[model samples]
Target chain A: MKNFSRFTLLSLLFLYLFFGNCIVGNFSSVYAQDDWKQEYSSVCAKTQNAMILTPEELKSYIDRCDKLLALINELEGEQAATEKKVYTKRVKMCRELYQFALEYKEHK
Target chain B: MAPIQKLLSAFIIALTVPVSASAADYSHYLRHIPPAENFGQVVLDNYSHKAGVLPVTFDHWLHRAKFTCRLCHIDIGFAMKAEMTEISAADNMSGYYCGACHDGKRVFDGRNIFGSCAENYTEDEGKRCARCHSSAEAEERKYDYKSFSEKLPKLPGNLIDWEKAESEGKVKLTDFLEGVSYKREPLKAQDDFTIKIRSWDVIFSHRKHTVWNGCELCHPMIFPSTKRGTTKYSMFQIMMKGEYCGVCHTSVAFSVWLCAKCHITLVE
Candidate 1:
């Protein structure tokens, strides 16, 4: 009786772990992308205001763009192709503009 | 005229125009200039035909006459290529792009600019919709290109001398929009530099171009490289093909046939 109880407890524990991971993975696929999409929108949204940014601020965004670009590049599957292309170009445009602003602030 | 027709005309000119035997024969690079009425007309039809509405005939001169190029291109996030922006009516109705100005609440020149789009419209509002979605050959236009160009300085091909028009303040350009644009220090003007060509080294004026383009329009996109001598441009690319300076000069800014404008070193 003691052995049966222990065996049942172990099986339940394994089952819980398996189902929990499946639920979490599914949730991540749906919700995880929103975080980056929001981040991208906010990051690139400030292009109109770039000239007003301080050198430090510009540098931070440039760094942020580079980091986002790296993670975005690592995104796999054909579904990610459009996102990868659009995001990569948008990020690069924002990054280059930020870099240009930094240089302008320093030189001019 | 359509972009296709422009290309065909340029090709025909390239074939017919006599190749210059000497440096002075700049006629080799001349292109056919569209008349004033049709010069800068852009048809926005990305979703128009499918939506059962006529394509919006966007007159570049009408808008650019009052607003800076940067206002539309950078701040408004409009793509340079026509129909490339993929502007949907839904986007406009949400107070983005054209809706940024055309919200119908914002007062420009003490008159309310009509709202760009709406989810539903009464019979009266139908007229407002027709303002943009008019037929291609629609004669009823609030701003006629011919009358508008009359006061502005004229170029060889009857194009508006935009540089002169701005310099003289004949047309005052609004560079900043209230909510959409933020206040910032003006760009410290960059020095004019010469772009070397074989027959004539072109003296490119940064100060002149900056007035209309601001900084964002050209930098890192059209002319990506900051380093001098990095980007090589041939007349073949400029006159016959849409690359480098041809991006604007061939279509909007001025004709490359006005060689004396850029190739000023030899002419002077």
Candidate 2:
């Protein structure tokens, strides 16, 4: 009976360590992916507001986009297809916003 | 078999676990070399390519040859990083940032040079737009770097010896602008100090830097004027974070490959 209790306790401990770590790791990874998407969206919003900015101010915003792009690149293989598409779209929007700011005239 | 042994075994396993496979090799970053013409050139494309306009290729060598680094970076508020400055067409036209000097009226020598990104450009004048907006492949540079630098005395590296050029009175740096700059008495620069590192001592020269970059360039921004040694920095931070000496030394001022320049004092 003592041996049975000892074996059962060991099994429970093993299960806790193995399954708990997997669950925690998976949750963190998902959380990080979501965080990246939110970050990209935030940068996109900033890029949209490029019209009112000076040349130097616009450059800093574009730099933020570049940094996000770098982060997305690091998550290349691990990223979900949907997430990848969203990131790509955000990057494109940022580029377009930057281009628009370049030739943007106040009068015409 | 005991709980202590089991815990010890787990700890050993954790310690033995392999690190990340994608660990970056920092050596490659330290060894990067920029092309001759493209050395200090930064592509400002915050919105150009997106707006169907070509990215503005700003060559530092071209500008630095004529003006001081402090003029644009400090006074004009140009960011050190390329594409980091959000310059728009309207901003330049109002005689701010690039427009401050690039205005056609600003005299360089005796010529009334054409204005930068002129708003009311004629059909014939439209062709001149490509002068600044030239792509990587289609650059139409008026001054050849090699030919221009040839007359100047040679330095150890491929870069033009800017310090020597300044010392010889070849390049006269203008510190103050008429409307833009608030004139004040230049602060008496502190004497050169030596900072000790592992087996080497770095001699920091304030005199050489103050010639082109006034106190405003480094003080209170890159390095605090409050007190010396208060801000803690490391070589890793300088190389990675692009702080301290890494700001200019890595790309424009001089390549970090010239180790002997700073790491002069060697311990036995």
Candidate 3:
């Protein structure tokens, strides 16, 4: 009876640790994804608001796109087909937009 | 007993819980270059194959060499999409669609052009039907795209640098058609503006686009010119082969991949 109770206790403790770690890991990943999405939305809004961008505004825009591109690259491997497409598109847009900004600044 | 039951239920739940998993393979359609002769050619098979008729092959390179895009797409009221116009034998016979130019009465280069798709034809006349109905392999074209493009000045890519050719007076595009287009005072093009798309500023050149397209070509059709910010378009939509800019950029004109062309501005 004592051995059975000890086994039960060890099993319960092992399950608690295992499931606890899993839940924490899942929550953290979800949180990280939400943060990345918020950052993307904020940068996209700022970009759209600027009609004729000043040099500083353009630089900020380029910087944001670069940051977003990095995040997209990091997330792309884990993404589904549809999510990967969206990320790939964002990456292209970011790269092109960054290049455009650099050229405009040089010409200006 | 209750504690053991709870542990068993918990293990079962853990094992059955769904994980965020997906198949890793992902791909997007990339445009491929067709042979010079077949570059702008399209095979219309909407109702043709269903009705047991061979698909109609329309060549943009052949027609665009003689007439402007506006002449066929705007003035003649042909839809940008193939087979969307629902062209019929009766419609052509009534001097509409292809009949407008292919009536045989219309003189081109001081010679009468042959009539197209007549309803009634003798065995001898039926032989002429093969000219258009012929498959891509069987068609004997009068003009060669390579020879025609070679005579004009060269561009970087395989496609003809139409904008440069037009600017250098190598090719002159006619904007009007008799009995089709109405004469009106041309509106002055709007000043160029920088459209902020994502983190980049794309310089929208009104003067450059208007040179070949004119007002009617884009107005109220591909774009609504009457209102500002009324139509919202995205690069994602364009990349997905949606309308607006992709109509020309993906197929005929310089591709969207050439970033420096439109996105001329830079950040200091």
Candidate 4:
């Protein structure tokens, strides 16, 4: 009886350990994804107004894009590949846009 | 004395005769214009064939008729060229890309916009799959470009006069999405500028372009330099080689063949 009870406890503990990690992992990933998405959206959203930004401001944006791109590339999971590709392309485009504005400002 | 008089008359005639740019000859620059329905249509086969379905056909005309260029390119982050987006069924079901709008629950034009990808659809629901995957059936499509475009303003060639249609309130373009796009101040368009060449001086309008493109579409991607006269490309480049203005005009816009549209001021 004691052995059977111990087995039940062991099985319950095993299931809890397995699913608990999964649930926690999934929630952490969701928050991580939201963090990067928010960063990406905020960074790329400024591209339309790039022309009006100062050269210093444009340079700063370029730095932000590069950093965000790195974060996107470092991501891993089921949807990581698609998310990485999407965010990488967008962040690079944003970086290029900022660089273009910086060059225009410097020339003037 | 007669010979000199003839020369003077010829010079006078040349000066008086307005340099009439061939308006109807926009087709000269195009290899072949797609039929009105096929215009701006792109079929993406990224993972469709791998997943045992026909390629998805995205008709830009229908989408652009309702949404602004910035909403997709800037807000949603859709790549400009074909197959560059690499969309997947999983991505759509997870609420990215096409899922942003076609979430099945969202209503448009008084009806629910069809969802892009679902978790599990039976074989009987193949009709729903065929909507975007392309069944080659006309009835499956909700919107018909021919009848819809018939009411809109016509350009010189097969293209629709989208600018006129929007300006006259025939079509109201939506520039914002609820969650995807950040709410911000409307763009303040710069004034018009003239690009002087040896032959025709082109009159470029920022206000007109901003209405459709919202600045980022051309800036940095098409035109690296925003300043006046900094970025230079000749007619040889645009018309013959398909560069600069030819990029959009050749494929989607009014086209580079319509010379009078841009080269309004003649240099001679």
Best by TM-score: 4
TM-score, predicted candidate 1 vs. hidden true structure: 0.71
Q: Which stretches of candidate 1 lie over 4 Å from their true place?
A: A1-58, A64-92, A99-108, B1-31
Would you estimate the TM-scores of all the predictions?
Answer: 0.71, 0.60, 0.56, 0.79
What lDDT would candidate 4 get against the real structure?
0.74
Q: Which tens-of-lDDT digit does each residue in B118-218 have in candidate 1?
A: 88989888778777888545654577777888999977767888888988989888888875554545566677998776556788898887776766677
Clashing pairs in 3: A101-B266, A101-B267, A102-B266, A103-B265, A103-B266, A104-B265, A104-B266, A105-B266, A105-B267
**In terms of TM-score, which candidate is stronger, 2 or 3?**
2
DockQ of each: 0.09, 0.01, 0.01, 0.27
Q: lDDT (CA) for every model shown?
A: 0.74, 0.63, 0.58, 0.74
Which numbered prediction scores highest in DockQ against the true structure? 4
Give the worst 10-residue stretch by lDDT in candidate 4 chain A. A82-91
- Between the candidate structures 2 and 4, which one is better when assessed by lDDT? 4
Predicted candidate 4 versus true structure: per-residue lDDT over B196-224, tens digit per residue: 75555788898888776766677678887
Which candidate leads the pack in lDDT?
4
**Better model by DockQ: candidate 1 vs candidate 2:** 1
Restricting to chain A, the TM-score for each candidate equals: 0.83, 0.55, 0.57, 0.72
Q: What order do candidates take by lDDT, descending?
A: 4, 1, 2, 3
Summarize candidate 3's per-residue lDDT along A1-108 as a digit string, tens digits.
999999999999998899988999889888888777666545543322232456677677667778876776677432333333344444344334434544545555
